[model samples]
Target: MQQAPTVLHVGWMSRAVDALVRSGAEVTCAVKPADAPAARTVCARTIVVPDPTRSTDVLAGLARAGLAADAFDAVCSGLEFCLLDAAAIAGDQAGVSRALAMRDKFVQKRGVRDAGVRTADCAVLDETGAAATALPSFPQVLKPLDGGGARNTFLVADERELTAALGQPEFTAGGGPWLLEEYIPGVEFQVDGFVEGGELRLMSISRYVQNLIEVHSGGLVAHIVLPPRTHPELYAKVRALAETAFKALGHHDGVFHLEVFQHAEDGEIVFGECGARVGGGRTDEVVERAFGVRLHDVWARLATGRPSGVTSSPGHADDKVFGGMNLSARPGPVRAVPSAGEVLDRPGVVYAEVSAGPGTVLPDTTEATNLRAGLAVVSGADEREVEDRMRRLADWFAAQVAQETSDTAG
Candidate 1:
């Protein structure tokens, strides 16, 4: 009797884990020690990762643990959580070496710039010398050379701010060598899609309501669905740039997330960043709701080299407009809370999820991590209706969460 193809899965992407298990692969889940418990639920076999960002450490540890690469037919990951570790295990040592290039932010930024892909001008800076060196411009953004979800990402408005930011406990402990880029001044968009057999497939763009730098400047606290009604032509131009970027970065088959900026003045698109993984923050869900296809399913099959016998539900009409809007309350102790069922009572609200319930102290608006309170998945007859419903939902969520007092009135 033949055995099922053994697959080694990496990262804390629960969505990918569920998909892979459901896809019928002999899945061995590998993740950081902190994430092992969650991996235990779906994965029969789990490996604890030490330092995922460093390829040398990962390779040595895995070998010392006696987990040979040849034992598995494929290795896979999606989120930033231990993605490189999974990539390193695929096929052979050469595969591990190549995964470093794909996973490192500095390498990806440099690769695209070398290929004339029009990325922001950036310089690599070490923690020791970052403060002394003169930055390219004021209001520059600093991110970990190989980090994601804006964990240590900061916006420096001047020399004083840069110094303070670098001294922060987060940046100091992050072990950097960071990437600093001239903050691209423009309307930002997140393009999420798949590149299969060297072709860009099912590309969609999400526009942010605010800048990612701050609470007021319109950071990623909220975003609208793909193809802004005003900028239809942007779809073509952004897609082309994203395709060129994916190829230049040496990705053949996998999901890709590309953050880009359309200049506020001239409307020219500039590359902000790119990753060889599925779009974070349930973006694949938004994409599925919009187009009726599950990119996650495609990505899982691609990772495991399995046939396209997917069990995910079908998608809706491509023309139908759907919006995935995030909501939150002011920084304070959560007093009262609203149930998901209650939030869904609003018109056009198809689905909703609240992360912090009553009594949960919401994290401050630092990065994407602490800012979001809940998200509403709504479908409307048109963009205006979608926007209105989103606004209503936000207001309703704020009202629902009595952030001021320490106790609920009821």
Candidate 2:
């Protein structure tokens, strides 16, 4: 019998590795040295590659001739920012149609728009002065074209706010390519699905609740999975909208995470953006536990040219809720140690992660704390019950921290 094909993943250790392993495939990772230690713990073997972010030309050169082609079956990338060049390389080496179409923000949005999907009114702000002058009405958003995880995203409430926000260090992270878009106020939703041979399969929908204002505030994400039993119409709409998007993007044979916005008052759904792979931040875990669908396995299966085992059960999709909350440390000196153990014990919480230990200094940035700190995933049979569990878990963590005070003795 032929041995299981070796899959070459050109990035760090991630949920994708675990998925590949579950599909009975031997996985070899190519990642940066900084991520080597963690990669070793997860994969059977690892190859240290130069940081994928540094230079696209260097990566292309390595891919064109330097890397050994006899070692792997296929090339794959998981994250949004890492896809373009890696996909280009993998596609070149494996002779696959892996040339990615999602790296350019304008192109990505344009593709979605051309697919006849509804999206925010966005324009590439090439002329910085003119772009800055033509800021949309209050509550508009500014972000880098090829950005993700809320990185380089800015929200402005008014003219003054918009100007001040544009001046922030975060706004320039995009380097040059940037966009300004009209913000849509509404309930945020996320869809993680796959497209095969131009066919779209809906996996899960998550309703994101932000503890702080704005869509890109780097605040906590309190969410619940949907196909809402109490509101079947809403669930169907969300699912259909996502299907339309998948069809629009012309995405085939891989996972895609698309975010949408539903106007709170009018219920108008607006397309946000889509990641061409599995949803990050333990979203895969939540979807599997809540929906009984193994997306990681499905993605791996599809990646290896096999049938994806994906289906919905008897109940409505939103009948059960599952999602995660991102945590962050308030800016200040550590006054007391925070115990994450209490959060781990909360009902419905499958796991809790805390990256910032006691005395670790953290600075505010456009970076979302998806993995910077830690996340807690909660799943339950009902939305209220699930949200309640998450709130309880959040409260536990909140209570553990004590701010440093000048009046008190050290």
Candidate 3:
């Protein structure tokens, strides 16, 4: 029998590591010390690094572990922060370039625009915290070049708001050169899929319950998958957009989580941004349940220079539409919250994870979209049914959670 391929997996995605092992590969994980324990449980070997996001740290850790770059047949990371580092270690110049395009918002949008794709007009902020070009219009967006989860992202409606935002400590302190973009007013949709050898093998699109920008104002972060059969025109547009954007960004092989906007008025699809990794939250779970394909499995195979087992025709196990929700708590001392089992037992609920419960203290501020107290995946026979179930689940969860009263404050 052929010897299993030796793979050096970076970061700490348990699912990806598990997929690599299941694919007959001997996986060696390079992860931060905090994740070493969990990595050991799944990988054949583990190299502890102080920080996986830093290429120097990862390189030094590997050397101390007595391993060379040639020791592994492939190097890959499922985490956003570690993508460029993994590419550098693997000596994949193409991968490095592609990773940069995906990580830096300005570079990403520029490339997509150059490819004749419609995207938000953006410019890089200079050292004085001023846009290098004139602002596109009011309701402009300001965000870190490499930020994720909508953290440090701002929507300034006018000059006064922009001035206030620019004076904020997060912007003034450091982390120079942010990206300023004209906010695209539309319904946001995400396209999740795998591209191999410059060809899109599988694609799935989902519509967000609300735009991500609303998260700052106490909005729930959730989305429902759109079945292709029900929305063929949307699927076609999204698929073409994804393929064009990926090709422009030089991402030939890997999983992608791409965000796009459909103009609220003209209904024209515009590129929002894209990530050369799996979507966040329970997106993988929702996709797998809806389409019967594990994105991580496809990513692992592509990383190892093997053929992705995914075919053009993704066979769905059932006709149920799926969706995911990030459970958030109001700022306070949590008195009680529903258990994961309680949530999973509900009708159409397939998966649930409750991280906040009795005695948990939630912070007053919400900065990121992924700052969840828990998560859940639900399914129904159609989009409306799935959406209704998601809203009901959210309401039910809120009703179950009890916060400490002001009188109880110590």
Among the numbered candidates, top TM-score falls to 3
Clashing pairs in 3: none
| TM-scores, all models, native as reference | 0.85, 0.84, 0.95
> Residue-wise lDDT of candidate 3 within 287-376, one digit each (tens)?
999888899889888878888887667855456889998877677788888899999988789999998978888664367887877999
Which numbered prediction scores highest in lDDT against the true structure?
Answer: 3
Model 2 segments more than 4 A misplaced: 1-3, 41-45, 54-66, 69-71, 92-100, 133-139, 171-174, 211-219, 311-320, 332-341, 362-372, 402-410
Error of 2 at 347 (Å): 3.9
lDDT of 1 by residue, 1-410 (tens): 12466777765667888877776777876667888899888887877767554556556656777888667788777665556666665645655545555677677777878877777777888754655464557878877787655677887888888888888887767677777877788888777777667777667777765655554343335556754454568987897788777777767677777789998778888888777667765577677787666777777776665543344433344455666766677777886778888888998887788888767887755555435777777777766777777778878887778774535544
lDDT of each: 0.70, 0.65, 0.85
Q: What is the lDDT of residue 179 in candidate 1?
A: 79
Q: How much is the lDDT of residue 310 in candidate 1?
A: 40
- Better lDDT candidate (2, 3): 3
TM-score-wise, the better of 2 and 3 is: 3
Give stretches of model 3 more than 4 Å off: 1-3, 315-318, 405-410
